[model samples]
Target: MAYRATMQEQMIRKGPWLEEEDERLAAFVTLMGERRWDSLARASGLRRSGKSCRLRWLNYLRPDLKHGQISDEEEQIILQLHERWGNKWSKIARRLPGRTDNEIKNYWRTHLRKKVQEQEQEILQRAINNAVNPQDFLLQQGDRSCEDDKSRTSSDILQISDYGFAASPYEDRLFDWISGSSSGINEDVRKHNEVWNMFSSSSYNLGFVSASGDSIWDYNSSSSSWNLDEDLQVVKQTWNTQ
Candidate 1:
């Protein structure tokens, strides 16, 4: 019996089913209703194994099986599903009608695999190119000038000017008060002129004020103290007069 079994196994066909074999297998599958492939193979008198017969029927020989180049829409679906499910080809095949797991797997190996790898490499290269060094970033920030900071501050004030008619309300009022007061220099205008003069002077530089830890008000040599509340009240009266 062992000798006979060995002879039978040796006699079994492998690789590339003939057209006659395919016809015979299909007829047997139709009569038997696609179950017990071992028995079906034996009954059909085909030398191919049950697994081989099953694969052939499902992958190619089936009448319902689709055989053509995969469409663009189908290719996109395969890519999306492959990304989500990984190498679950049988699972992926279930989503696509008439496409076998073997066909899908082979397509992925031949076509989609390299495409996916190239995409991953491109993304990695882009990330490598865009990566910023911490030290370089810090040095770039440190290299920025105080003049640039002042210009940015001036630009911010100018941007605020765009929201109003030509000049901001506070700037318009301050300019009007200064222009009007220049003709008849009152006590308030005199104090204002003193403040302006202090700002313009080289001794009381605005640039060094932050570093020196000195107040702009400290430049006042007069014994009379400047109260912010009193100054605000005088400014309100001046605005009222205007």
Candidate 2:
């Protein structure tokens, strides 16, 4: 019995099935029905194993098996189900009529696996792009605010220039004095002070010069001191003449 079993094992074929073997297995399965695969293999008189016979019949020889290319609708279904179940090809195959688990598994390995990985990577990249860091956002806002302030300051300087104040040191000093000291002064007094300060600034050459080129009113002379009443009288005379 042992020698006979060894002989049977030695006679059993392993590898690709021939067309004659396939026909013989199909005939035996039809005659004996699809149970007791070991008995069916022996009865079929084909040197292939019961497991091999069963796999070949179910995957290839079955009349209901679909040999055509997977359709677009079926591909979409496979992708969705794979996302939900993950690697359960047999479970996935049950939902797709006429598709074997082995066929589905091979398709996934060769084609769909890479597609799914690329989709996941694309989704990850998009999420990274949309997620802005809070610190970076604040820095951008701060930079924009600083730019706005610089633009506003430039516009103010331009406006001042348009009004005939050229933003010199003399003008800055005059502006400081007016802002600091002229708040409580009457309008007439403030105007008088403005005129006085303009004359006091060294940059202004408004004083009358004699023929010898000496200033008649040397307001620019540091050593010269004049009474406010006298200065006011001079200013009044000059204004009335103008």
Q: How many residue pairs clash per model?
A: 0, 0
lDDT of 1 by residue, 121-213 (tens): 766665556685543433343336333444334333332222322222332344345534554324334434444343334332332232223
Model 1 stretches astray by more than 4 angstroms: 132-242
Model 2: lDDT of residue 25: 88
Q: In order, what lDDT does every prediction score?
A: 0.62, 0.62
| Residue 40 in candidate 1, Cα distance off native in Å | 0.4
Q: Evaluate candidate 2 by giving its C-alpha RMSD to the native, one decimal.
A: 38.8
- The candidate maximizing TM-score is 1
Error of 2 at 46 (Å): 0.5
Q: Looking at model 1, which ten-residue stretch has the lowest summed lDDT?
A: 159-168
TM-score of each predicted structure versus truth: 0.54, 0.52
Cα lDDT tens digits for candidate 2, 1-242: 99999998999999998999999988998998877888999888888889999999988988878897887656765776576457778766755667889998888999899998897676666555768554344345444644543423333333322333222333334334433444332432444444545453422322222233333333224225534445546655664475
lDDT of 1 at 223: 20
